[model samples]
Target: MSGQIKYQWRITKYNPDYRDENGYYTLKEEWTCPSEIGKIIDGKEFTLEEYLDIEAKYIDTLIAFIIESGLNTLRILQLSEQKISTEDRSSVLYETEFDELILEEDKIVTLNDIVIISKMILRNFVHCQLYLKDRFFAHFGWDYYMYIGSSEKSLSAITIATERGLFVEEIDSSPYYFLEEDTTRLVQWSKKENELGMNEGDEELLEFPLEELRLIFNLSSQHPVVGNIKIKIEYKDFFQRYLNHKMDFDKYEYFFWGGY
Candidate 1:
């Protein structure tokens, strides 16, 4: 019962799929917890609770160490790669929590409201992607690339390659984007197509205007630029007697007033 506390640590190599001669691998270190007084320090003597606690603490410590080490590591890597932005390799760890204040069931629908909600959702998705990139790619030897969007069925999504991963940005849509005449029509058409067992034979048959809102981020970019690069409008919206569609055709009307 009076044995002195001892600690053991070992560092091992980490190999990822997308490894290159110049690419770096992680150095994983295993740290065993202090052994109990009377218990043998073998695998059988480790209790679940004690093991879990030690594992959790050890992982937390590892994350912190990785973050600190990554700062210098990333700098050197960037320098070697001829990249200037140090923030590009910053840790992407992010926390997502529901905001009660932004959860109102009813609010006056406006173009601004739609834009705000869309931006918030996009920002959250970007943050999460960045965090993952830091954890998996930056921390390990792999490269992480992502493009997040609202729907895959969207006509605008046609240009995206299927191999690339897609993530749906979630946000409260009812308050901002009202279920107006056009939306109702689209839903009805969609239901009709579903009931008839009609395959999406032609792009013109779909009612939802096929318009898609998208955001793409390139983690490998030296500047790490995130922007609304492309907008594709598939269908025309009829307000009163006037028809509005085609991003370039109705630039003033939609760009200035319509919520994107």
Candidate 2:
């Protein structure tokens, strides 16, 4: 009593209009679980208990692949536009089950630990799937980025823009320069009194002297809207600091948002 099973987890969000008196939208989360007959995996039909075991094994295998492949860092992107906010390496570890292992100086955290924590963060915090390089790519940080020592040198962390119908290109300097034009981009700017009794604002992009990492965005004249802009960051320097505890969750949030 077994055949090939096509299984998937689905989440459906209702429109805002479909809200309850409490102003909550209807969200449906669904998945199929075999209640009677066994499900076929590979060439073998497996009972519920056996299927669960294989499912866990498959997940573990994927985790092992990520760790063994040296995928130590994760790029945190905004869900709506996939704007690369910042890189994450340690914060998830501190928040997840690996906290004590991470906090203890005597204990050494491994690549496996980092990957598992990152996966958990993406699932629980971001509510996003933990996608591999081939599955998910990013295209909004810097102009050009490559991992010096990895075989999968693709800019997976900065390819979302192109996939989402935006072209990416390189410019002379940091994209933070746009902060000058976009008032909201800056946390604050100085307003000076002008000769005409008007207030002239003196604005500058926020500076992070220790930051070798730069946020890169490609803005096309054709599509001038912020939604069309794709962004990413040079994460190597930031990741190094994160590993050494030189950067923490609070600092990461500040840097990600460019201040409060």
Candidate 3:
């Protein structure tokens, strides 16, 4: 119950006076009226439970429907057809968001109905550019969040390796594998691909090997100055090598990183 909860919507337009142990009055799905700060919903307020009810039951549905229907975030939020019952709380995406997506359902749609209906949209499908930290960032699409939950002990080990300085020097004594510390990357250059091994496949997203995923670490924690490094293998060549050795981190390093 206490790990990262996956959420795609950004909360805005809520009251600031209310505070939680986690430091917010409550989460709203979209822009709220500034005057509605005391309330959980943007234009109006509801109890925390009310908000949770909206999220647990309808949030995923909203994402699913919008992606399936190719609609805007606000349009999906406000759609009257999405409501299941009167008892269900109203949506902030509906209450405040103010526009529609002028889409004819793009011609190049993936043919998988189940996946189209089930998956949340990760990458932006439209053309866009952003300026962050003095650089121009451009992207036509973005990726869905990757969840790689591991055993606590394995995660602890990974965390340590990510922090280790000159970990490349410790390959011989390393328990799982060696981590390389590389120079910090530019923020604008990092968003073009999935930070974790590029989606497995555009359709199913079969998980990528950790070795491929691990190479992108520096892109994620860039400003923090954490350890990330170049694996010295071309991205095009990674999968061929990965499939040859069964894709386990074990000895893959003994073979790949250390080149032993």
Candidate 4:
């Protein structure tokens, strides 16, 4: 051909324990092949095959590196929010690849010992296209979420709420409250006495512990809760006062974590 040629390669293996029915990975490492190998317009031009044959050696070098240095650690990051660190070092997630290099019958790491590696990397990527695709989905365990709020932060509509008695604010609306052994989903709502609108007074904080709050709702099948996701739910009723506001504990349910 008279024009320049570019390519890419895909290397994938499936483990039933780590993949779904369709073989999508639930845990995986990923990387990309190089693009831009300069131009054929004015540079010394060779046949496309000649160009590719020369480029293949670089990929070979990369595979050799994989067999030598190990892959990065897998971080169990928040699938819901982005955290900013205040340290001098800029922290970023490391890309992971083949978790534990599985060797062939013989355990060895070398280019000559292709039979030892569980995945065949050197032989792959020989003909892939040059552009990077959005393989964000390829990162394992990066899925599973129900988006809430208009903020850039994505919180699920539901979470395991525990430590039911104490609530502290994270954002004006969010609570830090999750790192405890307990958990919960934060739900946005209007305060009881007001309909939602920014100009209106800020909605009252939802710190009423669940134990006492449940009584106010007289939680029942008819209770106006945002969630019924749990199978085993029990009810308790108690009376308490907040600030100067006093109300019967038998008819209300403060915003439960399971709802919007």
Measured by lDDT, the strongest candidate is 2
lDDT of 2 by residue, 2-31 (tens): 111111111111233455889444443212
lDDT of 3: 0.25
Count clashing residue pairs per candidate. Answer: 1, 13, 5, 16
lDDT of each: 0.24, 0.29, 0.25, 0.25
Q: Candidates' TM-scores?
A: 0.18, 0.25, 0.17, 0.17
Per-residue lDDT, model 1, residue 160, is 25
Stretches off by above 4 angstroms in model 1 are 1-55, 70-260
Which run of 10 residues does model 4 get worst, by summed lDDT?
A: 129-138
lDDT per residue as tens, model 4, 1-260: 01111111122222235767874666644222212223342354334454344334333322332332232111111122122234312212111232233322111234433221212222221111110111100011112110111111111111111121111112221121111224333322233444442222112324556544434444432222223221111422222232223332233233323333
Candidate 4 — which residues are off by over 4 angstroms? 1-180, 185-187, 190-207, 220-255
| TM-score-superior candidate, 2 or 4 | 2
Return the TM-score for candidate 1, rounded to 2 decimals.
0.18
Residue ranges of candidate 3 with Cα displaced over 4 Å: 1-9, 12-14, 19-260
Candidate 4: residue 52 Cα off by (Å) = 51
C-alpha positional error of residue 134 in candidate 1 after TM-score superposition, expressed in Å: 10
How well does candidate 4 match the true structure in TM-score terms?
0.17
Among all windows of ten consecutive residues in candidate 1, which has the lowest summed lDDT?
A: 1-10
By summed lDDT, the worst window of 10 consecutive residues in model 3 runs over: 131-140
- Candidates sorted by lDDT, best first: 2, 3, 4, 1
**Per-residue C-alpha lDDT of model 1 across residues 167-213, encoded as one tens digit per residue:** 22222231212212332121111122255533222111233222221
